[model samples]
Target: MISGVVVKHFLYCPAIVRITELGFEERVTDSMMEGEEVDKETVGNFLFGVLKAKELIRKPVYKYKDLVGSPDFVLGFSYYYSPLDVKYTNQVHMDHKAQVLFYAFIMEKLGFNVKQAILYYIPVKKLVKINYTNYEREYVERILRNIVKAKKGFLKVRQPVRKCANCGYFQFCKPKRVGNFYEREF
Candidate 1:
């Protein structure tokens, strides 16, 4: 099964997905640990005090076919549900959007009405809403297809030095430092 996490990582850098598939363990950095801690501490404030969601589910695992996701929180409304994810960084990225959308996709498949997905940027106290549109759905599906291809050994592993510096699989990828940047040692 393709996990939502794998999808997020694949979107960031396909090499992360491929390295893990090859049985390499990721080295968790301090920032990653800090992110988890921040997620645990700030989720309550966001769910109850800010959004005022009717119901809040914490870390409920949802599975549909080959996709699985355990979002930080799932807010239940009168008519629909919203998957809320807490991000440590203030800036938003495509991978972050993909993670939230992946959760919404799984929720919809499991028969929950998901109208939107939410991202809580912890540092800046920002809440970004992503509407569950057909375009986003198709985008998630495309990401899933790419994940399948990556698992089947069809991935081009290239990433910028700045991103690789904090990646867990940095050691395994072993990008050679060239001048002022890093390049894969093909």
Candidate 2:
């Protein structure tokens, strides 16, 4: 099964493909972990509107064949559930949208109505609502299928691209120092 994080990497940067293939996932760093805690706290602080406790659903793992995700904050579950994902980046990336939408898709597969997915950007204090649509479901499925193919070695490793410079696996996958490059050749 593919996790939301894997989907994010596939969408944002394909250079990490080798890392994922090795089953060497990076540990969520301290700052990222703390951000999640803060996000939970922020949700707790709000007591009005859809952010209210009554609208929020907790402790549920949504799944579909080969797709699984446990959304941190789900508001209402039944005919429909609003999936809310809190992120630390002030800018909302496409992967973030895909992640939540994937969850919404799973919720729908499990026999619930999915209206939309919400992303709360902690730094900018912005809440972006991504309404679930047919286009998004199709898009996510395409990406998921490609990810599965990549995992099974059916797809060749994509050549490193510009995004590799900023990736954590940069050094391991394509180190610049001549000595490092020679060392990795063996």
Candidate 3:
């Protein structure tokens, strides 16, 4: 358990990102290689769009609360606030209710007004604006309270997730291996 003093407060951790992203990309490549048909969900294209937008604007980018403790993208604008987070999801807009609210909270805590939050859809080249309303603000604060409790093991895992062979951890978890994949780890 990490103490409050050592808790990583910033968003973008380069070391963690390198390790995790590489592992995920390796898995994706292995499954997608040799023209194997797999229903994979990815948000690379949406991230690209964010990058394109950033390139157009001359501002610093950072991932805060990272292991290194910095914003994901810190930009230098006339306004003091320079924190922005890019999230990609399959759903159009409202599905990302909890996460966007959390990001807004992080910004507020760091003394940023957080004027805008962008939710980009992968399948559709569409962007959605997340406004921090009073309702969402209160709701997210309640959720954050519950989340802190859960992190301390005061919460129980929700059950009844649909069983599927496609999830990567199925082999280790001993889920049904439809195509002999259950027997072989390779």
Candidate of highest lDDT: 1
lDDT of 3 by residue, 1-186 (tens): 211111221011112212222233114465444332121113323343554443222122223353112222332334433233334345553325444445555556656665555554444555555666677668755754543443343222211234224334433334334443332111
TM-scores of all predicted structures: 0.86, 0.80, 0.45
- Tell me, what's the RMSD of every candidate? 2.7, 4.5, 10.4
Model 2 lDDT per residue over 115-167, tens place: 88888887787888898999888988898877776665544343344444456
Which scores higher on TM-score, 1 or 3?
1
The stretch of ten residues in a row with the least summed lDDT in candidate 1 is 177-186
Error of 2 at 94 (Å): 0.6
| Residue 70 miss distance in model 3 (angstroms) | 7.7
lDDT (Cα, tens digit) per residue for candidate 1, span 118-181: 9888778787999998999999999998887777675555566787798878888787776656
Worst 10 residues of 3 by lDDT: 2-11
Top TM-score hit: 1
Q: List the residue pairs that clash in candidate 2.
A: 79-113, 80-113
